[model samples]
Target: MPLLLAFLFVSATVWVTRQAAAARTLTFLMTISTVVTLGLIAFFLFAEAIPVFERMGVRILLPLEGEMWDPNTNTFSLVPMIWGTAITTIVAILVAGPLGVAGALFISEIAPEQVREIVKPGVEILAGIPSIVYGFIGFTIINPYVSSELSTGFGALLPIGVVIGFMALPTVVSVAEDAISTVPESMKSGALAMGATDWQTMKSVTVPAAFSGISAAVLLGLGRAIGETMAATVMIAHVKELPQPAYDVFDSGETLTTLIAGNFGPAVGTEYLLSALFAAGVVLFLIVTAISITSQYIEERMKRKLGGEV
Candidate 1:
């Protein structure tokens, strides 16, 4: 039976490989598989979360005034977690944006060929380092320094934001570098021939021309920051309350990703608590999906503006 099954599998593989129509059909099937998988995931999340919505209504899930998330006591306001996610993402962008753009500009426009080759690879290598390693570094190195020098706390947003920013920097730098490098050499030459300095040409011409790509890169980085989980779960203080004054980066806070990661285990037997976690997952999925769609749209627009077809 095994021999016969193996022979049948080999025959099918060989037949598919030999036929163009078969190959195309397989590709279409794979694409549909991805869409189907995503649909099922969304459906599962919504289905699991529906119980909570039915039991408590939408107000409990999205309360405007209350700031607690105690499932044992029955409170389930997600505002604090939502705010934490937002503030951390914004802080990461603010830290990573200028540094990433400057690094891209330096590598693409200013560095000598040898220097550019070395620096670009080095920057790209940072992306391959595991997120857990970054989390460990933040917890061990950054947290202590901040505790001694600034505030004595576990969940200051600055250090976590900076670490997450570094994690996201490679994406921004790589995309922006590719975008800047794609600017036609003729444009730079024209500017130089007209007596424009290199800096002037880069600042006034190359950057403006690549703004759409840069914007897409930033959005992609923001998505990365928002969706990061293990690193944040380890480094953040994981407080359940809203930050005092609502703008305090130094206060301990908890993000949706971390909240879900840290609490889902205990919530398994509790129906409403598990559903609430699933609901948070749905929220995160929507946020990341929106950012990805926006990034793709910007990239498509940039390509069209550059005379490329869709």
Candidate 2:
């Protein structure tokens, strides 16, 4: 509906401009509508968010200093879930970053036109696949393989990480491909004309030119991996205890999203449960927002370095 209204407004603005003497009015209307839309969205997110935190003792902020998450015990430390979410996202991004960049490079720089056309569609199709399908695939295929080959028990994290890496792959590929493709062709041609190797040109010049976009893509992928609930829920063992010191990659851990999803139904209407879920949400929001802000800052810095902006 927002998009439809945007399109209709644009059409009306164009029509008014064509008629003469009404362009200013149309522009004013467009500005007002855009502000009103943004204000409404902000109001909604903030309104619900306040109550959610209020119930969770957010004003007192006890969860930060507490030890356990059990509500009946009045223990509500969020460190474990926070650690799990951070570690999983970090591991998944480490795996996905290089692979996603390589995939994007192949599509944007190396593949022949015909091959690119064929492969691009397949990559886009991956993004269209349902999250539940990925979850089922992770649970049925990846989980058992990890449990059998990696350890005698507690081998779920590795599979969930891999599944998340796969799930975020399409986003990274699509976004990074656009970034790589946007690199000035003249720069590539100049490097090639100077007798530089294809790999050298890509590594030293093209990728540097596209670094901001690649970073943005990576941040977006990390956001998706961090917020993913169903695949993690299905694939992970949903361990309640803190992960052991061994730090086995195969061991399962509960992330913030999985923790909330697993507990919400049973804890409904209970202030503790409601507050806990909201706290998780608040944490997720902060993490994603941080990523976005960092991406924008990097983008701005890169633009300045590249002289795209000053």
RMSD of every candidate to native, in Å, equals 3.4, 4.0
Lowest lDDT 10-residue stretch of candidate 2: 58-67
Among the numbered candidates, top lDDT falls to 1
Alpha-carbon deviation at 30 in model 1, angstroms: 2.6
Off by over 4 Å in 2: 1-67, 152-155, 308-310
- Each candidate structure's TM-score, on Cα atoms with residue i matched to residue i, is 0.89, 0.83
- For candidate 1, lDDT tens digit of each residue in 1-310? 9966775686578666777765676577669868999999999988998877776677654645554776776668677888889888988998778888999999999999999989999999998999999999999989889878886577677778888988999989998898888888999999999999999999888997888878887887898899888788889998878888689887778899999999989998898899888888888989888888888888778768766565
Model 1 collision count: 0
In model 1, pairs of residues that clash are none
Query: What's the true lDDT of residue 210 in model 1?
Result: 89
What lDDT would each prediction earn against the true structure? 0.85, 0.79
Give lDDT tens digits, candidate 2, residues 1-310.
9987887887778776675545665678779988898677556555544654554454323324434566775456566677677677877887788899999999998999999999989998998898889999887877777777866354367678778888898999999999999998999999999999999999999999999999999988999899888888887787754566536566667888998898989878676556666676667777777888899999999999899566
Separately for all candidates shown, the number of backbone clashes (residues 3 or more apart, or on different chains) is: 0, 0
